[model samples]
Target: MKMKKFLAVISAALLVISTLSACSMSGSVEVETEFKVEEVTEKEGTTTVAGKTFVVKTNDGSGLNLRSGAGTEYDVITTIADGHTVQIINQQGSWANVTYGTYTGWVNMDYLNETTTVAPIVETTAPSGATSSPENPDTQSGGYLYSYAGFNPAEITINDSSWNLTLLNRHYTLPEGYVPQLSEAVRGSGVYLDYRVAPHYQEMYDAALQDGITLTPNSGYRSYQTQKTNFENKINYYVSQGYDRVTATQNASRVVLLPGTSEHNAGFAMDIGWVTEDFENSPAFAWLMENAQDYGFILRYPESEDKQAITEIIYEPWHWRYVGVDAAKEIKASGQVLEEYLGVR
Candidate 1:
């Protein structure tokens, strides 16, 4: 399944590169060197050419992509908005290395306008000496905007698109009807993860197995109703212990999420090992803590007061969550919870 997805994505990207490379770059050079372009389609916002400056000219709502390499197959650095000026670094076939703010990546030359000078971005200060408001986050100092899709707290909600890197925590809850894809996590565990997360989980499990570690997926996605019942049952037990119903509910919530709030419903969080503190002493837990980030998984709750302060959850060494590989690497290196890394906390 992963191979098919990989092939499909790669094949489509290769097609785009093939088409682009076939296009001619024969426009008259305004500078000493000739950069490829069959014709200058738009001349209005062009700043500089001949490998010095090029303006993005997608000419539509869809912006041009700046990629890691000179091909569509490379990862996108960011999207270059139409008419936005850029500083060039180098040029390869059908692509040019360009600088967009702090980002440096390759962009398709077909969607560029050649120019003679790099235009300055004029920062507009607030009129009447009024301070900037939330209505325009860009007006704040050190707030130059880029097209990178950063973390969004709104995606943590029940109606969120599951494909997003949603931060599931106490504040975010899954919808009652939110049943994401489920696939068997292992051969015999009968456990399953969200289809979006299953492959990465499998990859991590396999790697851990190779290292003689028994990293198990004890639990995965749970239905909202199931979590609600579990919370209620825990609440009932606490109430039977001579606590008031409200107090019991609150105590119950400390351990179990009140239904939709459980990260299990998100299908990315999983309980591994034996679900005990002793698991932290196991070689499996040690291996996972060190290597899971390679597979896009992170120990969701570590035994750290600082992390617990931000996550508002007790340390659970057995709990792991799947963010993306990039985010996971950053989180592991920084030792921050999902909330802090995402700027949500």
Candidate 2:
């Protein structure tokens, strides 16, 4: 009987060992199977376009302007800045069709670069001792560090806000570091316009669009330094045409404004669509003539005014300036230049 009991105890010991081994194997498999290794493939936060990625690169403050069509003449949709990612749907000679956030437009190919992968821009806290507007620090604040920044007349009033009616011309200049409340009219035009004037321009643009007319603001805000560069380029072009230096300088001044004196520096002026005399004959011009004043703007220089005697600048239908609505109406009624309306001339 004692021998029988010993054999039975051995049998139980063998069964216990076998059960423990099976449990260990099952545990091992569970641990190994539960952990998964995933592959890191695409760049994080990068936009995918046409199965390829392109990044925006703009060193100048001028953000890449996205247009309804391929050319500058097309309606501006928005402006995008450096480090932004876009997907290119199609490419023409100099423009690329792209879509960003439910808006699609053409961007200048010169500003786009194909890249392996890139992430969207992340905002960092402002540095010490610098306060930026909570609204649009990039546009409204001064210290535009780059050449693409816009300027506001330094002496613009706070007591009786000029509301974009302030006069700036050859006789006046915006003070250095005068910053206007700027907002982008489109996503990527990088045109930091006066906050007050941008809305009016858009309303006018929309109004014109309803009538099948397209009026695009090709040039809006310009820094004094930019104006200087344009002025010098104009002088150089005239000199290349065999004009004497003195004659070229004077001629350049008549057309290309002296750097400090251009109305463009004020951020209130806009050069729309075209710069040639032929612009006056377009349907858009006729529309502007009959209706622009209602939107609080005036043709800064009209062909009817004696260019030499009245404004000293050549007549240009493309240039328009913002005055207040009431003032614009009166000026339109009286047929006076801003100089005559304000009695500055």
Candidate 3:
């Protein structure tokens, strides 16, 4: 009886040892189980991770776009209205993965303001000296003002349609939902421009063709969202080349203007032929240098250090802007950029 009791005790000790060995062999089981739980929660349109609340703040009052992925190339899930709050789950560079109501997506962190509590709306009358009227509303008293100060985004909202020479750099932006009356600049080529610019561009194209040079319109009339996608793509390209998010954005802006600040977004610009410096050496460019102003077009970005300083844009030989025959002639004669001719610089 004593021997049998000792054998039973030894068997129990061996069973405990085997259980520990099994656990050691599958050490990641607990971690895998926990990860699966989080994945299930995410699939259910909820997150188990703790998050902080942030409010959407934008200059144009257009709110912010929530995307399926962290980049603008991703599909838009929805547009979160300005002043709406979102829960930030994680951050990747300048983008934040967030949840707003039942939807979860990513948004540009630049447009978010952190707050522990929602701020109350305040009402106040305009200042005593401020003057606004139907004839000259406050937003359109004159042409939208452009600033020379560097790299400010969406400072002014353009409302006046008569302001064809309206300056749109980083400082001035079009109103939200603003889309100009558009027509195909080159029929069947799929390029479009504002109605006011189409006839002039067609005339210019015909004239170039008469001179045995074909000026092909490659791009024109980009929507605000399209511009955003383009800008973000350029930024991504730079980031892929070892640039950090901040530097990537800065570099991208030099080539692709921020969403609302682009002339393409305004529908008053066109990119012709090859969009490269090599266009500067083309016969088509030489023809344009001599006669584009006659048809109300001007080389929007010229190769001059002084102009680049004021315009804050690199020389793009193929980009042209339509600014009426008179304005174009004056600009060409004065050897000045649009900013300088308009006395804005």
- Top lDDT model: 3
Candidate achieving higher lDDT, 2 or 3: 3
The total number of steric clashes, by the backbone 3 Å criterion, in model 2 comes to 11
Candidate 3, position 65, lDDT: 84
How high is the CA lDDT of each candidate model? Answer: 0.65, 0.65, 0.72
Candidate order (TM-score): 3, 2, 1
Mind giving the per-residue lDDT tens digits that candidate 1 earns over 97-148? 6655423466888998777765432121212433222333334344212101
Poorest lDDT segment (10 consecutive residues) of candidate 3:
118-127
lDDT of 3 by residue, 1-345 (tens): 999999998997898678767887988344222212234323332333226678889999977987868898986645676877877656776787765542356899899988796332111122343222232222332343211112445556555665579888866777647788899997786778988899889999988898899988867887887777666665454444455544555656676787788889888998886554667998999999999999999999888898888887888998999888999999999999988887884
Q: After superposition, which runs of candidate 1 have C-alpha atoms over 4 Å from their true positions?
A: 1-164
Question: What are the TM-scores, per candidate, against the unseen true structure?
Answer: 0.53, 0.53, 0.57
lDDT of 3 at 320: 94
Model 2, C-alpha of 27: deviation from truth (Å): 99
lDDT at 216, model 1? 68
Candidate 3, position 319, lDDT:
91
Candidate 3, residue 238: how far the Cα is off, in Å: 1.9
Angstrom error of the Cα, residue 44, model 3: value is 27
